[model samples]
Each structure stands twice: as structure tokens, then as C-alpha cells.
Target: MTIREQLDALSAERILLLDGAMGTMIQKFNLSEADFRGNEFLHHTKPLSGCNDILCITKPAVIASIHQAYLRAGSDIIETNSFNANAISLADYDLQDRAYEINVAAARVARESADRYSTGAKPRFVAGILGPTSKTASISPDVNDPGARSVTWDELEAAYYDSARGLLDGGADILMIETIFDTLNAKAAISAIQKLLDERCSADPEGAAAGRYDVPLMISGTIVDAAGRTLSGQTVEAFCVSVMHGKPWSIGLNCSLGAERLYPHVAALSEIAPVLVSAHPNAGLPNRFGQYDESAQTMAGHIETFLKDGLVNIVGGCCGSTPAHIAEIARIAANYKPRKIPEELASGAAAKTVLSGLEPLVVDPAVGFIDVGERTNVAGSRKFLRLIKEERYDEALSIAREMVEAGASIIDVCMDDALLDAPRAMQKFLNLALADPEIARVPVMVDSSRWEAIE
Candidate 1:
């Protein structure tokens, strides 16, 4: 059977076990800057001491050994050590040009390790880890300038495309976009991977028909704080609504919070997400000295609650977890059945027009009429148009806030004035509007006569 088929069949029977932390295990090696360089760049310009992704090239055996340990401890799925191998993140170490090489190496090492552990009855899968890069597309780095973006959507798409292609070439069974702090960044990855998959299908029709390129995608987001919102300020439902267009095989939460703190968010996802829900929280929160204090048994105790409640189809560890943690999780997981996917969701019967900004607004007849504030429309509101012309964006965003405060479920924004660059003005205003939580809690209706401005 193909990996997707096997995954579906096996997950329907019982909860799948994912591996524990790679960085935690790598820390045990106590390697130096020289070790990270591996004679490849002994006299390089920048310091390469703590770049863990580089280990796939510098110390393949070490990475493989870690994978083997997780597999031995009973991980049905092992993620490649390519978390920060994307061009954007690798630029810190001046290794941005080698992103493809690093990703390929990472997946190849994990692939070899998983293959060794495979059997007729029990097969292992490799999940190509696509970490949220150091930069974000939705949020502004400069607090003074809400419209300022550190990274563009195009840059993110190109970086993810290169990393994803390398992983596919190196034999990854699934692509896991994990620890997502920004929904827009995740969207970029989904778009890039979709493009790559379509290209592969076009290049090899026979292979596509045989399910050779039918790799599954698993998306997991991170809840930044106790409020249960991503760093981009999206609620669980809004985040799901934003990325559900990707048609992921599974969606869940990982990183940021520990198991106990992350439970409510995962529970919320399982309730509404049409796909399988997975959770791999950290081994409890960090201590004052910055370390995970939860033991294997303690962490497993929390995960047992998830299993008992039928909240997850896949469960495992994240930061600060070890092989022992995976063993305990695997042991407990064997006792519980996986969460069942909703029939309506699986059959496409639960489809609805759901709009979101930071919060979701389900447009249904049951919920009265939706009030769309049109004061932000430049063509309609002279004041809004004047504000844009004067470059007074901060004051302009206040108008959007006023609309939301006046009970507008959705804000209608338009920049169709001939004197203004409609597309540029629309983009700038929307970015600024989304930066404010009060305005972002409700959706925005992009009203534009120009298709270029709307797109």
C-alpha cells in the first residue's frame, strides 16, 4: 500500500505515535563550533555553533542514530531534521544557498533510518518538517510601522518550494508543516507544496496514478499564549478556516505551550476541524532556568487524558521530550482508539461560507444578517479617501476600528480612487488594519472594482 493508504488504514484502527524532540537529543552530543562546521567550512565568516539543521550534513550518523532511537521506542512517524533548513532561516549562518542540499540530506538520513525499521506489519513514515521560519508575513517587525513587513509572500513561497522539492526528491512520505505561528506563512507553504505536487503530477501521469507523488500533508499550528490565539492573533477556528483550503490530511497544534495548557486548543480543533487532529506538546512548560521539568511518565499521564477523551488521532512529544517519552506515549496509545473523522466533513457535506480575520464568522441564515461596515471604502467615504491621500494610515485604521466597534461583523475596505494606487493603498490599509486586534477580530470584505487590487 502507499504511505497515505497505510496511514489511513492504521490511523483508523488506533492512535499513531510520533517521535520526540531532536534538539533535546542533539544537545547530549555536546558538539562544538568545529563539529557543526564538519571541515566543510572550518574558516567560514560567521559562527555556526548552534545551527542544528546543519547537523544533517555535518553528522549524518548522529541524526540517523536519533531517528533509530525514536523508531526503536515505537514512533510510527519520524520527522526529518530539516526544521530550519529553509533558505530564510539558514541565512543566519550564511548557508541560505545550501537550503536544498540540507533538506535533501535531512530527509535522506531519516528515510534510511525509517526503512531499516520497516516491516510487513509495521511500517515507518518520514514527515518532512517545515518549520515556521524566523520571519513572519502577517505581523510587522517594527512596532511603529504597522504596514512594514519583514518578509513577503513571494519570498516565503520560493523558500518553501525549494525545501519541499528537496524533501520530495529525498523520499519523504509526508510533509509536516509544524509549529506555525503565522497563518499567512502556513498559507505560503501550502501554496508552494500544492504547486510542486501539481508540477510532479503533470511530469509523471503514470506515477501520479500509482500514488507515487500522493504524499500526505500534516499541518500543526502553535498557540502563542494562554488566550489560545496564534502569534498572528487568529483563534483556533479562524486558523482552521484559513488553512482548510489546503486540504491537509491532518491538522493540530504543536510547540509553544505544554500539554496541559495546549489541551483546550486541541479540544477546540477536534470539535470543528474536518480532518484528523494531532497534538505533540512539549514535555510541560519550561522552568526558570529554561528546561523541561516533566518526566516521561508525567508527560504521558497528560497524553493519556487526550487518548481517554478521544481528542487526538496522533500523539507524541515536542521540545524537551526523549525516547522514553515516546515509549510511554506509544504504550498508552495502544490502549485507545483513534478519534473518528466526521462523516459530513469526510463527505464534503459540511461545506459553508466561513469568513475570518482573527475570528471566524460563519455566514448562515440561522445567525441573523451580517453588518458590513462600508466607511473604510475609499470610493464611498471621502474622509477615508482623504486619509489615504494624506498618508495618515494610523488615523485611517482608527476608522476601521470605529466600524467594528459600531457592531460591524465584517469591514468592507475599498481603494478604488483613480488618484491613488488602488492596489498599493488597499494592501497597505489592510495590513495596517489587521495589525490591530480589535479590527482583526472581525473579518474584512475586500471590496474593489479592480481585480488587481482585490487579488
Candidate 2:
């Protein structure tokens, strides 16, 4: 079913409940490395330890049972056990080639369990998990060169594409990109998902599954701390704007913080984001021993405030949460109506005339006169135009940095040169420019005389 159909079916309730921590439940099995391998890697040398995603293929019963538990506990959504099933994360166990196999099996397992418990009253939906990998794309591994990153855009894109292909093949209803710490990394995943959608629609004009529904997309990020910013140094609002291109089904904060600590940040998203807001925080702050001691009742009590105030449409747990915690959340968070997407936000008016680097350049009449860096233009900087013609995106980023340092609040990115593929040039330069904190910390004004580039 499409996201709208699911929502219409469950229209009686607000705050569609999502399942709690997959890692926490996976630990309950107490499986060994051999169990993780399950004959597939029986002869392999490298340890298969900490490879929870592989359990979908090896320990199908255990994984399905976990999904069953969440469904019984009143969860409307259950995520696939493929958090680390991508090529990047699988390299740790030397099972990179099995990334697609791992994800397909994981999604299939979760789908079966969700279908078993699905009902006309409260149908279950499977969300394919796209995790934030071990590497950071926006931060430099080498402090000496701030622009250096551990992962390239293409690598991240490829991993997400492989995982997404497998997830869809196994019948997932939605794609959830969770625990996002870097907005650029999240962008790569989102881009890959869009690519999948384009390919599917192109191959089958009616869409996969004969036009039943499009796989709804959802993105959840991490606040990181009291700073109220992502690990990439973007405020909650800026993070929302950075990934706005994805046009997610829902956007909110989750993980790294407990229910209480996550409240304010979630509230911020509810106020600003142009989509449904969802939050899944940890049970509570870990104690000195690194154990989550927050009881299920206490966690539910805290999450209740969000429901009472209508700040979230989806709520659940992250670290150290279980079915019992989800049960309490489901019991208390019912009857409340889903937070309505404001007519203005759903119309996407907030997306226009805004270049968000560190903060948004909100181009409304209320703001002061904005300074747009016009030097990236052919008329202003012959060197910039020349570099664009040659496709030197790296050098192009340097020019953008200079423009930001020159006191411009918004970078007027013009890729309208006839010699260039305007759309490709615009996408390349924006990807590079937005990855730079110096440029990303402000808004970007996409300028083009050609409608193709503007679109």
C-alpha cells in the first residue's frame, strides 16, 4: 500500500508507533560468531563478530521473533534488520560483496513477520533501514586539511544504491534513513533512493507492484548534543534545509539522546520541518556503567508530552529500548490526532528563496537585504566560468569559499554557461559547495537563465 493508503487506514489514530531498538533486541539472542556466520562464513578467517545485519540470513527465526514482538506490542512500523548491511559497513567483516544478499534477506524476514501480524485495523509496514556508516563525509579525518574526508560521494552513493535495490526487492513499504549525523552523507543516501525511484518508474511506467504505491521515504537525524546541531555543525533548522531536496515523508531527531533530552530538538523540527515529524530517542541517559536504566514506564511518560502537545506523529525508542517500552508508548500515545502538515509547509513555500549554509537566508520581506556572492558568475569571474567549462569542481569550491569569506550571506551559484550541462554543473557545484562548512553554513541562491538548471 502507498503511504497515503496506510495513513487513511490508520486515520483513527495519531502518532503512528514505530518499533524500538533492533540492536538491543538482537543482543537478547546471545549468539556467537559461528551463529553470525551460519555456515556462510564457516571457513572464513576474519572474525564475524558484531555483524548483526548478517543474522537476518543466519538467524532468521530470532530476527523474525523480534519483529513479531514489536508488532504484538502495537507497533505500526518495523524496520528491517539491515542497519549495517551496506558495503561500507560490511567491509569490517570482509563480506562487502554480500551487501545486496544481506539486505534482501533482512527485508524479507522483516516483511514476513510484519505481514503475519498485519490487520485491517492496524496494518504493519516494513521500513528498509539505511544506517549512517562509520565514516564521516563532511568532516576531515586529517585536521591539517579541513576539507579532507574519509568517504567519497560516489562510494556512499553506491553503498546506498546496492542496499536500496535489495530492500525494495524484498518488499519494503518505506525507506527509513536513520541516525543521520552528517547531512551530506544523508544526501548521498537520499540521492541513491531517488535514483532507484527514477529507474523503477522508467522501467515500469505503472511503477513496481503494478502501481499499488510508491515506497514512501522517511529521514531521521541525530541532534548529537545540547548544541542542538548535527555532527556536521548544522543546527536543527539547517539540517532540515540541507536535506530538503529529498522531500521526505517525515523528518525529525533521534538517537544519541534520551526521550527527555530529545524533546526540545524534536519540538524544533515540528515547528520548522515541512513534513511529518517522527522521533525515536534512547530509553534514557546511560549510567556510569554504560547501561540504560530507564524503565519502560518512565520512557513512555516522557514521550507522552510530545503527544499531549502534538509535536510528533511517530514515536519509539533507539538504544536500550525493548518491546515492553514500546508497549507502554503505544498505550499512552493513542487517540491523539496526527500532527497536520500545515497548508503552508505542505505547499513547500519555505523551500524557495532560501540558501542555508550554517543558517537559513530566509528570503522573506522580514529579513534585511541579503548579500549574494555574484563572483561565481561568468561576467564577474572569468576564471570561475573557465573552471566550470573544464569541470574542475574542486577549484570551483575554492572560489565559492572565497565568496563566503568575503562577507556574503548567500552564494549566488550560476551554472548557466552554454558550454556546460547546466543541471549537472549546478548539482556538482552545489554538492561540493554544500559539503564545505564555510559554504554550507550559509544559504545558496541557485541562479540560472535556463529553466532546466533552475528546475
Candidate 3:
């Protein structure tokens, strides 16, 4: 069935079952982190390592095996192992060209696995997964830091499109946009997916009505810190406002905290949308040894608690969760009576913006005038480079924030270096400025006299 149909069915059913961690399952294969991380290029097929994004590239067979295992264990929905199939994540390993290949293959792998594992009894669904970029949230302005760093929207958009297309092409039942901390990126991803769906629909009039795997879209946010807020400092309530605008078939939490820790957040989110509620938390905090020691039984017990209390519609594992954990969850889940969810939710303004998580750098939508200061431009001054580096971030963020704060809808950033790393420094500075939560979502003016800097 298509994503929309599956979601419609879910609303009528009791609860849905999503699978557990692919990475942890792959780790049982004994592969190193680097090998798993770089699998797309190397093309390792062994099951020694955990399930990595490379499966979408090199080791698709392994990815298939894990998906099949979950099906055998009784999961209703198996998430495609394409979490890092986006262009940006691929770029880190210089595999950007493979974004489409990776995502499409990931979906196909899961599809094949679901078909192979089903005993002709219960039906299974495949969900295409999208994860966040690698950049840290501590530097983003939306998180209230304004100092957190990131990449530009244009750069991110191109990547999101490539990945989204792959998932659509490969025939996924749902598009699962998970582990988002920055709301803007989430908007970009969902918009990218919608754009792809639109393009596909536009491409073939008959197919559009037939709903060729035009999957239901699901958006999930990560509450990373101890406070249970996103890196953008959005409370659960604030984040829900942004998510609801997307009109996802379902909305909930994933990654970041373990199942036990995510309890309160998941409960709160379920109240907002009449859609299905899902949570796939990590095993627990990793230890100094980088080991996630939480047992399947323990994880299942916690999931049981949540399930009994009516806290979630679907339950699974995240970072530290394994197939065993999935097995435990499957066993416990079979006993519960399915609950019904409402088909329609209270309507409101649809979210069209591609940026949501950060506070907009106050811009006077009516005018554009930003300031620039030179506090560290002295000869032979190490402090100058340090401060220049700092100010570029500050200015990018502050101006963006100031623009956001002052109500200047647009801002211009200029980098002058009669100083050092004029070109490189300016590039780094502007990149951060553009990425700053304040300006990360806004347009930027890269003012550099050096032609090289512009390049």
C-alpha cells in the first residue's frame, strides 16, 4: 500500500510496530566504526560491523538481512537503512554523487527484505528514513546559542532532494524524517520530499491519482540535552507547533535520549496530533567504553510500561537497540489490543517554510541595513585571528540575530582581511555565519574583496 493508505489504516488500527537499530545489528558483524562509516566507498559486505548508511551503497545485502530479521521478529514497519543517504552526509566521505543510488538502494533493500521475511501472515510496511546532518547544534542560534555552526540551506537542499528522490524511486511506504534537532533542516527535508512527490505526480497524471508509493510523511524531533529540548531550545510545545504545520501522518521522538528518558516528551507530543505516536529511543547512554549494555529484556520492560500507559502507538529501539531488543518488544506488543486514532486533526495554517527550528534572525522584512565591527585587526596579533574567527561567527550570528532581533529582514556580511587566512578565514567565517541559527535560515551577503574568497 502507499504511505497515505498505510497511515489511514494505522489510524484505524491499534498501534504500529517500527523496527530497532540497524547500526547495532550491523555491529554484531564485528566491523569497525570507520569501516562501517566508509562502507559506500569500500563496499564491505560482511555482517561483522553494524548497519551503516553504506548499506545503501556497498553492503545492501547486509541491510536486507537486518530488515528481514525484524520482519521475522514481527515488526509491522521496517525502516529503510538510508538514514545518512543525503548528499551532505555522503559529502563527508566524498560520496555525494551516490545520494540517489544510496537512498533508492536502501529502500529496495528493505522492500526485498520485507517480502522475503513475511510468512504470508501479517503485512509489513517499509519506511524510508532521513537523518540530520553531522553539524553540531551547540553553535546554532536557534538553540539559543547563536554560536552553533552549520552549512547553508542551498547546500543542504541539493542533498535533501537527491536522497528524497531515491526513496521515492525505490518504493517506500512512508518517508520517515527522524532525529531532527534543527527545525529548519526538517522543513527543508520535508519540503524537499514534497517537491519530489509533486514533481513525480506532475510527471505522470495517471500515476498521481494511483498514488504510486507516494508515502505518508512522518516528522520526528530530537530532544538531545538533559532538559528535553531541541538544540534550538524549542520546548516540546513549540516544536509541536512547527511539526503540526507539516500535517505528517504521525509525529514523535527518536535518537538523542534512550526510551526511558524520552518518556515524558513522547507523552506530551501524542496529545497534539491525532496521528500515530512512535518512539525508538537508544538503549541508554553509552558508557566510557562506548558500550550500550542495556539488555533486550530491560528495554522491553520500559517499552511495556509506555505501551500499557497509552503513551505510544509504535515502539522500537534507537542507537543502542538491537534485534534482540526488537524481539522482546515484538513479543510484548502482540498481547496489547490495538487502539484507534482519529482520522482528522484540528486544522491550522499549513507549514510552507523550509526553516522552522531556529528563531529567525530578526530582519526588518521592510528594510535591510546591518552593521560590521573590526575589533581584532592589528598586525602580528594572534588575538586578532582568534577574535576575527570569533567575530565572523558573532557578526554572522549577531547580525542575523540582530536583524532578527531588530526586525531587519535582511542583513549583509562583509569579511575584510588585510589580516590572515583572508580567503580561507572569510570562507569559514561566512559558512558559520550562514549556518548560525540566526542567519542559517536567512539569505547572506558574502562581502569579500578577494575574488578567491568569493570563489
Q: Which of the numbered candidates is closest to the native, going by highest TM-score? A: 1
Q: Lowest lDDT 10-mer window, candidate 2?
A: 4-13
Clashes of 1: 0
lDDT of 3 by residue, 1-455 (tens): 55577556654565667898887787777766555556344553334233367656566666777888888777888998888888777666666677788788888888888767655446778888988876532345355644335676567667787887888678777888898887767877777877787888898889888887356888778897767778756666557666665668778888877778878888777665556777888888788998788898988887787778776777778888877888888888777754344334434243222223332232243434443333223233344455666654554344346555554434444446554567666555654564555544444445657787665
Model 1, residue 7: distance off in Å is 0.9
Q: Candidate 2, which segments miss by more than 4 Å at Cα?
A: 1-3, 8-12, 208-210, 348-352, 366-368, 375-407, 412-439, 444-455
Instruction: Tell me how far the alpha carbon of residue 430 in candidate 3 is from the true structure, in angstroms, after superposition.
Output: 14
TM-score list, all predictions: 0.98, 0.86, 0.72
Compared to the true structure, candidate 3 yields what TM-score?
Answer: 0.72
What is the Cα root-mean-square deviation between model 3 and the actual structure?
Answer: 8.3
Which candidate's lDDT is highest?
1
Put down candidate 2 lDDT per residue, 53-134, tens digits, no spaces: 9889888999999999999999999999999999999898889999999999999999999999987766888999999988
lDDT of each: 0.93, 0.85, 0.68
On the 0 to 100 scale, the lDDT of residue 342 in model 3 is: 38
Alpha-carbon shift of residue 166 in model 1 (angstroms)? 0.8
Pairs of colliding residues, candidate 1: none
Best-first order by TM-score: 1, 2, 3
